[model samples]
Target: MIVAAWTVCAGTVMPAAADTDPRGYLTKMKAQEMWKVADGTGITVAVIDSGVKDIPGLEGRVLPGMSFMEPPFERPDVSYPPHEDFVGHGTTMTAGIVGDGSAGGPRGLAPGAKVLPIRTSVGTPMAFAVASEAAKGIRYAADNGAKVINLSIGMTQDWPMGKIKPAVEYAQSKGVLIFAAMGNEGEGNNWTNVIAALPGVLGVGAVDEDGQVMPFSSHGPDTDLSAPGGQVLNRCNGNKDWCVGDGGTSYATSLASASAALVWSAHPDWTANQVARVLIQTAGGPVDGAKRSDWVGYGAVRPRKVLLDHEGDPGVPDADPLASPAPAKAPTPSAEQTAAAPRRVESADAESGLSWQWPALGAVVALSLGITVLVKRRRR
Candidate 1:
């Protein structure tokens, strides 16, 4: 089957050349320091992606979750048990959130939390057809004791929102905080995933180890936050080996969701709004001094600022700090705008004077069998 435009947002994965340590993202974000304050205990993060496997580091931490990859959503040629990963995207994402580093696997930012894995047809040809399944996943997550939902998936082209809107609203009403990837369409396409643009969902972008936004991270007003995504270490597809992701907003969303888990675990009584408010308030805002920017939203997520420094006033618990007026239709970028976009970005505000750029990267993996490169359309 062909890969769909809407795929897992883990980006291009390749066998690790070096840097096998999974602590890169944790060290870059300075998450270890915050772990002392909150390791996401008592929080269940729902991972809605290409399913999750009970891997080495995630043993005993994964709760049983339903799979939507049946009949209409599943390709006739492929079949797998519920919660079994096909592309390993969900497993990697789960590792990012709660992996405990057992058996020498990737370590998560929130080692004390549990994961609820929701399987869907992400990274498959049926991704677009299964768009409604994402909504169903959201509803299922909200009803199943999930406090935070992570959507490391998105479609390159806009999809119908009839099912997604209400599902997101339903999850939000249940006090669930949703985080989604801002697809890898990059700046030229400037496409924002419909799911990420929802009223309560926080759309996340990606930043590299150098603290600069990667070229492939999408840009737009809906971009709510940023996190580490470049060259992240992840588990290989359906295997025990480790692979390095070239960078995608998917990892960023996972880290951001984990950040919320840490904050929420520390302040269990705080509502979702209060957690979000603190995250945005403590984030490193744009260097240009703007309150919010399309490139990086409120700024790069810095949960440490809240957990370590005891920063951020958890103002009114019910107030929506990230809410904005209905988003206007985006305008097409002119020749000059496209030509001026930069390859690497250090600022998220519009006035930063950096242009946008898009560069596609491919994934190559060397499994026990052999080496193979995969080029597929996938999640945001």
Candidate 2:
């Protein structure tokens, strides 16, 4: 049973200032320059989250996907459309990947791509059910022509092995790349992310405009790369459009998924392994020049290096860069270790019904200070 209390850290808002075009994240990644080459055309990113609303920015872009929140999978009373968002979290994530900015929403980094909405609960209380649905969602996306799957949701607890692992392997076998959030536990909770830790899945962490990793972003060997998740502008629920999603790995994962869409669209013939390899090779490594680190993994994702500079070499088509050597069978976790494991670190979904505000300068300073100490300790 889950022992830790469920928690969602309050984020400091940084509004989409009029000057920050296409949102701060796109600007940081030099997305405009890359857009001149490819805008995620001919790509479909499956967003498995709360749900998606067919907002104006997403006009004619969102496909009618399936929902797992009701009936056979969930309570019959909780039914809703795949196009309807439950908490606006999924809509924000969807906008991050494919919004066109027609309704004053921040334009998505990959505006030319399409979104397949797989509606499911990402709230804290339904951990087991969510995991089952998430695994199913991954397989569904793989079979239904999605080139990439975005799971902006994560859980602290691990479900049974066969559920999530086999689904991920199936998706990888079908050449679909899954980008999952590394969670928002930070240093305090520091839970191991279940889906993100799986083999062949790219576990994404969050970074800010200054390129420092966000304090709320979970860190570990599973962290494959970082992306701009701070001061990011996007449309919230129907009522509150244009709220900043700052310091959550959910948005970071979405942006990473969009980045994959960009790379894949540019080279339609490339396999999933090639796309995955090129992304890692082009990523900006750790400041100390290390090949990899637990904090930001290979470092912040810099797709511009591949798209604009034509830098990355798409390696062997069948070779998986994220794959690890098969592990020897291990002993089961001790009772003490099992009891010590954190249980309900919340999903990395952005806050709903947030009022617009300017960037919190003080919070930014705190983040920097926190990272400084964490880095020193991590090095040791």
Candidate 3:
């Protein structure tokens, strides 16, 4: 069944983000053994979830973010006050990717990384009427200075690649890293689609502490890596100091994004694809990519190898992360892919100038993999 989509125009009446604890996301990610390399100091992670408040660990650190939710009619709906995290899900996800806050309990993989919250909803369907909303979020994140984007939710429908695909492509063009949950319905119905399966996205799956794939972790062809996403501790409501644990691909995706942050922060000169390649090449604890299972994709994420050993080459700097989606063929419900439709591209108010975030060594031509080198120069 398809859900009705709503519009969230800028002056609409929207609720504020919940102010409760949100540590569940981080602690679990760290416990999975992926934090050893995540320092994320120079990276900015865009968290598209319920809403993120200025909690203790995330205050002063989070920049102004946009709330794509619609409000009643008048009154400011800044996504901060009224909609506070009645459900601490978004905060937990955000914390997982980049939390340094003390009060929550668990710390993020990249303590120094910052977050740009895109207050979208997992509960209600909005302006996604045509799928432009997802694109809007992707573009907004890229244009604003977010080096990585994390989408932790999923829809129950299977729409073709129209607006959503391009939005992901555009973000990649601007050098943004996109990560989405593989889904938590592993043992259940296990239906998957959209943002998570898109060409440029990094589809993250969930695994347990035993390095075994969680029964509920969905097994789609899009899953790129398995990360700790089982029962783990995190922040939630009440007392604001208490912590709890839950498991889902959302947590796995968050940690994957943080892992990327650590590698990028360390090698600021590398492009998003280079960082991604380095990661896939060094991913941990042997599982067969050849005999791949429905549970674990590639393998459980082992980020320490990337930071400490740097075993593989960064490949071409301009290579597309999804350039070879051919390798990760996820099984679709229908043999036929939904019709591919082109869509709109929205510009964001955020700008990085690409300078403050990282230095440009002036290569005019970035390194390209699988091809002979051709020299090009932009004289300063």
Best by lDDT: 1
Model 2 root mean square deviation, Cα atoms: 10.8
lDDT of 1 at 132: 71
Task: Tell me the whole-model lDDT of each prediction, alpha carbons only.
Answer: 0.69, 0.67, 0.56
Model 2, poorest ten-residue lDDT window? 371-380
Across 51-140, the per-residue lDDT of candidate 3 in tens digits comes to 675577666557677766544345445343312443455677776666664663457777778888876533432323324445677788
- State how far residue 193 of model 1 sits from its true place (Å): 0.9
Q: lDDT by residue for model 2 over 147-188, one digit each (tens)?
A: 999987765545433587788889888889888777666645
lDDT of 2: 0.67
lDDT of 3 at 261: 86
Number of the top TM-score candidate: 1
Off by over 4 Å in 1: 1-14, 20-22, 72-80, 237-240, 324-380
Model 1: lDDT to the true structure: 0.69
Please provide TM-scores, in order, for all candidate models, with all chains considered together.
Answer: 0.80, 0.79, 0.70
Give the clash total for candidate 2: 0
lDDT of 1 by residue, 139-224 (tens): 99999999999988764434346777778889988999999888676745665566777776788887765456666677776787
Which stretches of model 2 miss by more than 4 angstroms?
A: 1-11, 14-22, 71-78, 124-128, 234-239, 324-380
lDDT at 60 for candidate 2? Answer: 77
